[model samples]
Target: MAVETGAGARAGMEAPALEGGAVLGSLLDLKADALGTYLRARQRHGDVVRIHVGPPGLRMDMYCVFSAEGAQQVLASESANYRKDNPFYEEIRESFGNGLLTAQDADYLRQRRLVQPLFTRRRVDGYAGAVAEETAGTLASWARARDAIVDVSDEMMHLALRAVSRILFGADADATTDVVHRCFPVITEYVLRRGYSPLNVPRTWPTPGNRRAAAAAEELYGVCDRIIAERRAGGDPAEDLLTLLAGAQSPDGEGFDTAELRDQVLIFLLAGHETTATSLAFTLHLLGRHPEEQARAREEVVRVLGDRTPEAADLDRLPYLTRVLKEAMRLYPAAPVFGRNAVAAGEIDGYAVPAGATVVLAPWVTHRHPRYWSDPDRFDPGRFTPEAEASRPRYAWFPFGGGPRACIGQHFSMLESVIALAMLLRAYEIEAVDTEVPLSAGMTLRAEGPMRCRIRPVRR
Candidate 1:
């Protein structure tokens, strides 16, 4: 695979290289399960371990940090030294283009600056109504069911997609949503596979994988183009996020063309929705598994919100629900592992990291680090209480990550998730259809397959 650092306050000790099981080469291990491979290496070699990947000259060694200290050094303390064109991002660019999630250097800065205002407090607060509306719509659909043993994972994705669409482009996107519902999975599947593939297959190569990836990307972009075209053809749909983004002018004074607009729309639809959906799905999954916690969360919902949908102001009133969401993210972070490649020499925990080394920052591992969390594997929302949170390092729980480049939509995601959770818990009693919920890693962590749940309506 293509090759890959951070800093310190030293160059003497080389970071320990991961050995043993990885002796068969990193490809074999990664082919098994990339996250597992990294976890095993970290377990064997400590917080920072270097693993060599790929075949022959194409092989590269990447330094992965699975500790809070390393996260601080690489993400916060010396963040400027690592740019956006990290190894994982290189794979992301093909699908996302130069959008905020994939842009680098000046491009990334410019994009972040332009998009930051869109997620301002007022705008995010205004979107709460839309989030609640979508959640209500989902409940209505479930009510129409005879038995209602619905796939919560799919429902979460659908609901999130609808809410984000309403926010971005206004309502009534039947055609566009259908295409995305069909094609988004194909794009993600190919992206994850190629992102971890040992073979250096170029996107231009007409191999089966490349063809499938390209086709999916094309259809998804096609859906975006259709949305823009419909909006342009039908005149204004009041003033919304899409209108603002479309009218936004670059530094040189030129507005984004159709292609640039498509990129932004794709990134928002892809990154914004999927992560939120996964977070909500896993939150519900966990709540369903632990009935006691679910009951507590629902109690808070009932106490704060009698029977009406949750409002933006009501979010603060239910602190236990917030803790439940925070704990869920800590246990199963939506965007688990994202990497940053060093643009300059840096040191982490006294270990020297050269320029171009990819440093993996995994929230999944760090959030569960024994050093920072007690009973790391346990699902205890009490751990997120005000006193408990204050006792730990700020970076110890980074479901939204740390530093300047942390998610711009953190507020949006939290509000949407909190609203959805409250509404769902208020309406029904949920239980996992499967005794053990399996896990899988994509761009974000997700349930292995469709996570089906039994929804029993609560008596009024």
Candidate 2:
């Protein structure tokens, strides 16, 4: 479709085509309204669409594959060829350095191997008591503030951050929470803005926002560094992630240096909490909107553990709650869009993808694909039931991604979500105050405004 340009045209050039050029431009503008444009293109142009967006000579391709087979191909089968290389990583790498999330090739593999054990099911299960205690405490506070509108997004972030800090560092830096909280918003704003803008500015340049973000990054690093130094000086051998890493020795009997330790800590603090917090927030939003499912989940939780706190063993009994989280992730994946740069020439479902081209596989698109889902847009947790789930293909629902580079924190996040949801539902009945709020995409998919809800104590 041809659309008129809002601005005056240049002397020698005609207006950019709306179907491709103008649509691409809107994405670069980072306007929330551009979502419909992208969705319409997906509907009209099939799975893969090409547009010229980035710097000259670099053509970006956007893939909206809604098939299980296609998702598997991109994430699992040919994953090695697809490493993270995009504007998102470019901005993150500035502050985070090449930690596991941003590392590639041998560096990535080595780091992932070293850090993988800390997030194992066995290790994560050990933290269940800590998770439950923190969650119950948070819920008690929420209950005290009866009938007040709460930003579930912020609440979840705080809860997740606390759990992560307790498990990872074995310390509760409540006094430092204010400083850490202030730092993230600055980083998030700068990264999101830079991801979309066309203006290329050096980070060292004296931009007010850039300076603030840099200072925040430095402050965050300083806090982590001090903690590490103190732990080293005290020389207490604990099973926490930080201590585990400190004592960890490779086959060659080597351990991470100060710089490497700082990088890993920063990556964990950012990736570990924010992603889980977003998932939990969206899950709660879904539960509020779907009262029937929420009730079913609560019943399941109550039946499993009458009045006691949930333990690691109780996780398997709460099948309904597990399905609920799985379904929520499908609708609003924390890391909705993932990209990879092609290392060599490849073909994705018969399309000739050239070498060095960027390939994107969006769970946001695939999870709701009409071909795989019965009613793609509906909130149906039952779809994740064992029989129903078995009927679907392997990669049909990958909220935590797939294959080697899949999120190492998947087990930890799932355990945390289950515990948090069970504890919260056990205490309160939640209902959405406004169900019409639009879903906005950010660092993670979140509601544009606070997900206001009414929480009443559930009568035993």
- The numbered model that scores best in lDDT is 1
- The residue pairs in collision within model 2 are none
Q: Give the distance in Å from residue 93's predicted Cα in candidate 1 to where it truly belongs.
A: 1.2
How big is the positional error of residue 418 in model 2, measured in Å on the Cα after superposition?
A: 0.5
Error of 1 at 45 (Å): 2.2
* Candidate 2 ranges with C-alpha deviation above 4 Å: 1-18, 22-30, 33-38, 54-59, 63-66
lDDT of each: 0.81, 0.75
Instruction: Kindly list the per-residue Cα lDDT of model 2 for residues 254-324, writing each as its tens digit.
Output: 67777788788778878888889988888888898888899999999999999998998888999999999
Report the error of model 2 at residue 1, Å: 36
Tens digit of per-residue lDDT, candidate 1, span 1-460: 6332333423446788876343445767666676677777777877888888776667677888988888888888898887677545677777777687777677777777777777888878998998998899999999986687888888999999888888887754555677777888888887777777656567898988788878888887877787787666657765667777877766788666777777888888888888999989888888888999999999889988997778888778989999999998998899888888888877777787888888888888888788898888899999988999999988888978778778888999999999999999999999988757667667888778777888999886
The global Cα lDDT (0 to 1) of model 2 is 0.75
